[model samples]
Target: MEKFYPEFSARFAQFLEHIRGRRIAIVGHARPDGDCIGSQVALARVLGTLGHEVLCVNPDLVPRRLQFLVPGMRFARTDEMLADRTDYTAIFVDCADHARAGERLKGRFPVVTGNIDHHLSSAGFAEWNFVDVHSAATAEVLAGMFFDNGLTVDAQTAQGLYTGILTDTGQFRFTSTTRRTFLLAAELMARGAKPTEAGFELYERETTGKLQLLERFLASLRMECGGRVCVGTLPNGIFEATGSTAEDTEGLVDYARCIDGVDVGVLIEERPDGAMKASLRAKNPAFRLDRVAAQFGGGGHACAAGLNYKGGAAGFREKLVAAIAAQIAAVDTPEEKK
Candidate 1:
């Protein structure tokens, strides 16, 4: 098999050697998405097969669509795991930083054994970090590593990996989707990953409440920066009114980003406690929205990023628009015209 990440092959080998017989905690980010949950499931299953006692940990329950992937296993929530106080070697998957796994999880497991991720904003906060920013998804990185190292990737594990790649690449529509992405996906299919099943479950199973939430989000869209940017908001009480939760807000920002003239899109969610969480997406990678997210101490890929703020949604919107508008102006500025 072709080694997509040659540099990390030996490191993965060493990682396997270190955790062979140890109790392992496979941690994923908060409000886990397809890639995050998929990486956790696949890695936990792989490690379990190798004689390790593996437990998947997350700050939130698996989203409805992803629950099917972890049928026989259980995801140990941070609160419950903290209650147990079991000792394990912590390995973070799909988390850009330790805190992305949630403050409590990071606090409970201050020392990390290994980190595997594909986000540009990853801080390498572990003893061994395998971050491939070029990979479309963390599942892609793990798939390549497993194949290269001759590890067993069974049908269920393949489904988990395939689902991660499928969603993270927007069904191969994102610019981040590369030839290697397609190749790895094909390999996974051969290993028993049913795209028909994954697609039907992920897309065709949307609930009426989710559609109501989407309608509300679309109605809130506001154009900025001469229509080059679009922003929307989900007020604190909107979730209750629409019978939705934060997970239902997933992919809502894409609607703002996919507009023809829009170069960037934003989604702001107001919490009950006056805290705001914002999701940012851009059409081009050069926009480096990750840096924009970093200004507020959040992190993600260049094209997609997020941040949290301790202020009202309106104030955060003003600050975020100004930052995004400044970036647009810089991009429009003529070099020699100076």
Candidate 2:
């Protein structure tokens, strides 16, 4: 891939030249995370600085905490922009597939270009793809592109890049974070990225309702596989009692992962339609939650993944636990053989 960097860079440059005066739509996944939000915002800033018209389209409203990061971001909620079939270019960032853009925008535009991502699961969903799963964050990829292209990284650009790198890497604590991650982070900081301030705003700041939701999830924690796996559930009743919104449940899977003697953690949230959304976390390097999630029609990174089950809460919980247990058994069998 190193040998092809120059070629890829040249191709990307050509694509940027084509987009010079076009109306471009930058999109992220449905439920955007820091990496998704940051990549789109950073790309939008770069394009806007280049005198191109760009709109950042997010399926949902930007999280309250992230609103301050991308002040110029535009929210495109309806399918009209996508269906009009007008002369507009589409750029998807940090999404694994075009489907990740949501059904509303998929296959609606002709000239799809730009592919800034850090997920191995990305299906090369653009005319120009720049995917490096080894990178800790998509923002890292975008930052490098910006630097390579001679674009200036102002304070806001630095902030957006910092948030993307920080959250996706779990503040640089995840295994995927390497020397390159810190190197890029340091460079961004030198260009005015303040990690201390961004860290506090992104993680330290939480609402009371979110705290109550965390307590409820913690109370429902369960263990399995000789304490190698921990599971937790959040029922709608708990959400009602705590006045917690769905957004409040974001990062609750980390709680199960933090428990001592647990190699894998699972969080199941009961949806209003009786189905369940499962979030999986694996601390053990040998465990690949992405494979586990794919079995249920979902995919993500190795350590973290998610799946949606279409059954009653009881049945969904039962099947999910059994599936996770099977994966655990498969991993342990090799050790037993050894």
* Top candidate (TM-score): 1
The lDDT of each candidate is 0.90, 0.80
Question: What are the per-residue Cα lDDT tens digits for candidate 1 across 69-121?
Answer: 89877699988989977799999999999999889999989999999999997
CA lDDT of 255 in candidate 1? 99
The stretch of ten residues in a row with the least summed lDDT in candidate 1 is 329-338
- lDDT tens digits, residue span 167-251, model 2: 9998889988887677778778888888888877787889898999999889989998789889999886677789877877788
Where does candidate 2 stray beyond 4 Å? 1-8, 79-86, 335-338
lDDT of 2: 0.80
